[model samples]
Target: MIGSLDIAIICIYLLAVLAFGWMFYRKQTDASSFTRGNGRLPVWALSLSVFATFVSSISFLALPGNAFAKDWSSFVFSLSIPITAFLAVRFFVPLYRKINSDSAYAFLEERFGRWARIYASVCYLLTQLARMGAILYLLALPVNSLTGLGLEQIIVITGLLVLLYSTLGGIEAVVYTDAIQGILLISGAFLCLYFILSKIDGGFGGMWQEALQNHKLSLGSFAFDWKSSSFWLILFYGFFINLQNFGADQSYIQRYMSAKSVKDAQKTVWLGGLLYVPVSLLFFLIGTALWVYYFQNPLPEAIPADQVFPHFISTELPVGIKGLLIAAILSAGMSTLSTSVNSSATVLLTDIFKIETANSLRFLRTASAIMAACSIVAALLFLGVDSALDVWWALASIFSGGILGLFLLGLLVKKSAAKLAVSIGLVFVLWTSLSQMFPESPWAFTLHPNFVIIIGTTLIFAVGWLLRKKD
Candidate 1:
């Protein structure tokens, strides 16, 4: 059972988050201030917000779980971030800053027709909902393990806390709180790694030897195969998906708009994007160290990879420290959830409902409440899932809908790529159905699931190219 000291620490952390959120409730006097902080936020805060949003509970728990169970294959996916960051800083940041709209899909409407904007907006909303649900479900795992609470109950508590802060402070609260949570989680990660290393026999050397012997450091196959999550395949998937995130996702574009200037916004991309590389390495090392520690000290029975870290936290850590670390895990989920809630509300007001400024704040809050409720239901539905991280990656890729391709076609080709919208949509639906529904059928998509976004984006570009008209 979790000690009272630890539980108190967690409660304090939760209340502190709410207090911080309330501090900003008054500043969000208008829709612009609520959504993007009126472009007055410092680069450092925006950068940290981006970093915090990118590193969710998925990274906090899933990366270590993945490294412990399999290898560092998924780390290759993160490796593609710098490349995409470069593209974002060069092309995407400037584009969004130039457009200067709260909604990134506004650019799509400008280039394509209104249908293109709505389609992309709907895709983003669905993706955020799924993403939030998975994070909330993952957050419940450790809390349930520690406190004996049902997953459903834990989901409601945390979901409501996140909703409270997000709905109150809007994006400003979300960003600043994200910075605070980002710092807490990273500190917690470092502490966990220290304890994990100290527990092993030879410390870092022993852990390194065991990882080498067991091949935990492998980055998966480097072959040209598309049917597996090879290094190249993950790189491709990560690059395109990260592009869609930096270039097309409202969650990110909002950060761009929140920065003080275009230069600061561009710099935020590099700082936030590159910062994850080292941080991810640290998490992977934690996984490798845990593997070594368990090798020296075996569990009574095998558990799922996703549960290994949580189990360790629940069973092994010291009392007060355990609570702090748990708070870190909670911070991961809450920061990401808060960001998604605020951004999804922004999308609803700016793109879907087209609300006037007079009623935008009211609409954003109501929309956020509805989104939070739906996310809680989705979290409850996700109970008993084997791996939240894997499920999230697959769903995110499938629902991405080649938004990056359409963005590129509109920007580069300078044609009314809107004409290819129906064709692209059909291709997306057909490919998704075959890949997901009939994986065993001969006609099903045979390539690795990560290739869904890659193939969809490629087809969009190809169809648009063929249908292009001269300027």
Candidate 2:
């Protein structure tokens, strides 16, 4: 169990976050300010905010777990971010700024019509809800195990705290808090790495030798097998999926709009990408170090890889450091949850309802509350799920397919047909569902899970081009 000092540290951290958010409360006098902030945020701060928004509790908890359980295949996903962000800065950012709209899906409405916008918006909402739920569940798991708190209780406390700050301060609150959290999480990981390496017998050299001998250093299988994870498969999936994140995702586009100018937003994208690579490597290194640490000092009983990091935190680290690490985990969760709530509310008010009035602020706040509640419910629903990270990745791929497809169709296919785009999107959805449900079926067996988004996206563009005349 954590010491009283640790608990106090956690409480202080939570209160500080709430107070920081409350500082921005009075500035949210209208819907615009609430959703987009004052448009004066520093590029560096927004850059960190974007990084935090993307690197949620999943990265904090699951990335280490992944390295603990498997090799470095997943790190390839992080490698793909910078490439995708480059494309986003060059093309997507300017397009979004050109549209000058609050909602990311507004471009879809302009190009593919209202149905396309609504379809993409719904997908974005669902994706965000699932993501928020998984992040909350992952965050609650460690705290519940360490502090003797019920999982449900932890979820509610964390969710409500995030909701409070998000509702009170809006995007400014979310972004600024994210910047702080980003720093904390990164610092916490580096500190953990330091401690882990300090404990290893020969330090970095010993850890490397152990990892190499155990084959934990392998990137992934280089085979062309589609039934299992492979380097090419992950790299391909990472490239396209991250494209969805930067191109079609509201959370990122919202950040883009919050920037002072197009150049600032572009800088935010690139800088965030630059920061992510190293921070991600740090988390993966932590996992590898944990593997080596445990190899030297084995656990008495087997535990899930996901539980390994938290378990170490509870048993190994000194009290204050443990509290700080926990705070970092909570920071990750809150940063993501806050962003999810605010962005979902933005989409709800602007894309779905098209509300532009003095009352829009009230409606936006109400929507934010409603969205937070729904996310808590979703998080609770994910309580028993195994491999929270894998579940999140699969859900993200499935939900993002149609939205990504539509966006690609708009960008790549000239004379794009709305009806055909919608049809292609539905086909992608059906393919995803069938592929997921019957992975063993011959046709689905050959289709790698990682390639789902890539294939779906290609079909959307190809079919739209082929059927343009029909439309």
Q: Which one wins on TM-score?
A: 1
Residues forming the 10-long window of minimal summed lDDT in candidate 1: 416-425
Per-prediction TM-score? 0.98, 0.96
TM-score, prediction 1: 0.98
Candidate 2 root-mean-square deviation in Å: 1.7
- Model 2 residue 157 distance off true place after TM-score fit, in angstroms: 1.0
Worst 10 residues of 2 by lDDT: 443-452
lDDT per residue as tens, model 2, 1-471: 799889999999999999999999999999889988867788988999989987898999899999999978899888899899989999999999898888999888878779888888888898899999999999998898679899999999888888889999999999999999999998888888999999999999999999999999888988877667798888888888888888988888988889999999999999987788888888899999999999999999998888899988888899899899999999888898999999999999998998868789998889999999888999999877768888888787777755777787788766766576567666766766796798787766345556667777777777787777533
Q: Give the residue spans of candidate 2 off by over 4 A.
A: 438-446, 469-471
Candidate 1 backbone clash number? 0
